[model samples]
Target: MSAELRRELSRLDTLANALDSQFRIPGIGMRIGWDGILGLVPGVGDAVTLLPAAYLLYKGHRLGARRMTLMQMALNSGIDLAIGAVPLLGDLFDIGFKANKRNVALLRRDIEARIEEVA
Candidate 1:
């Protein structure tokens, strides 16, 4: 991959990691991140998190991701936003869903595929 693409991917990876699984549970070996924390705020929290997720989707589009790939990314984010709007259940859902992480993974895979095609 080009340096610019690598850099962008790295940045998105960092952001997704921080937002999805930066914190570890004390004993269960589980992890959660800012998404979980912010999700505690109810309606606004899930909405706020969607911004980054949407950005990732947009990045995927700009990078030439296939329509199906973009749709899957959107589906992931939509599921997260929909279920994440609930009360206690939503916070729990956010902890496990990791929509941003999933979106980045999709983006990374799409970029790698493009690189392979170019090669």
Candidate 2:
């Protein structure tokens, strides 16, 4: 991968990790991130969280991800947004789903495959 792509991926990875799993729950062995914290709000929170996820999807597309990979990323984000629309349970679900992380993994895999193909 090019340096720019590597940097962008690293940045997105950091952002996604922060949003999805930044903190640990000490005794319970659970973790939560900004997404979960923001999910405390009703409508606005979910909407706000969707922005970053959408941006990641856009970035994935720009990086030349395959249609299927893009679709999978969209599905992950869609599920996160859909179920995350619920009030309390959705917030809890967001804590565990980590859709952003999953999307990043998908993006990385796609990038790696492309690199291998080029090689």
Candidate 3:
């Protein structure tokens, strides 16, 4: 696939978490949310987050992301899955943590580092 397409896929990879919570709270633009609600759906909630993450991994591979970076992505998803599988703890975990946001952050940081290396 083309680089642009990979980039777009990467963008989509972060959406599962997006639907779970409003990155920034509505109207006021606050950066908190009711993300814990997604955890109630059990399998689907976690799957919702996983699919996008997998897309990210696939696109990241296509884009030549380092093995370490890909591993980091896997770790991120694993943690998300682990934390999201519990009962009340999982809901609280989702509310407090945004793994998808963090993964996207990782990808952006990786891209910047790669650019610096090229320069």
What's the lDDT for all of these models?
0.89, 0.92, 0.67
After TM-score superposition, what is the CA distance of residue 28 in candidate 3 from its true location, in Å? Answer: 11
lDDT tens digits, residue span 5-64, model 1 = 899889989999998999998998889988888889967888888888888888888888
Which scores better on lDDT, 2 or 3? 2
lDDT of 3 by residue, 1-119 (tens): 45875566466544635644556656965453333455678767766657766876786677677889889988977887788888778866776667766666677677768878988
Which pairs of residues collide in candidate 3? none
Assess candidate 3 and give its lDDT: 0.67
State the lDDT of candidate 2 residue by residue for 8-116, as single tens digits: 9999899999999899979998889888888888889889999999999999999999999999999999999899999888988998899999999999999999999
Off by over 4 Å in 2: none
Best by lDDT: 2
Model 1 TM-score relative to the real fold? 0.93
Candidate 3 local Cα displacement, residue 24, angstroms:
6.0
The clash count of every prediction, one per candidate, is: 0, 0, 0
TM-score of each: 0.93, 0.93, 0.72
What TM-score does model 3 achieve against the real structure? 0.72
Task: Pick the winner on lDDT between candidates 1 and 2.
Answer: 2
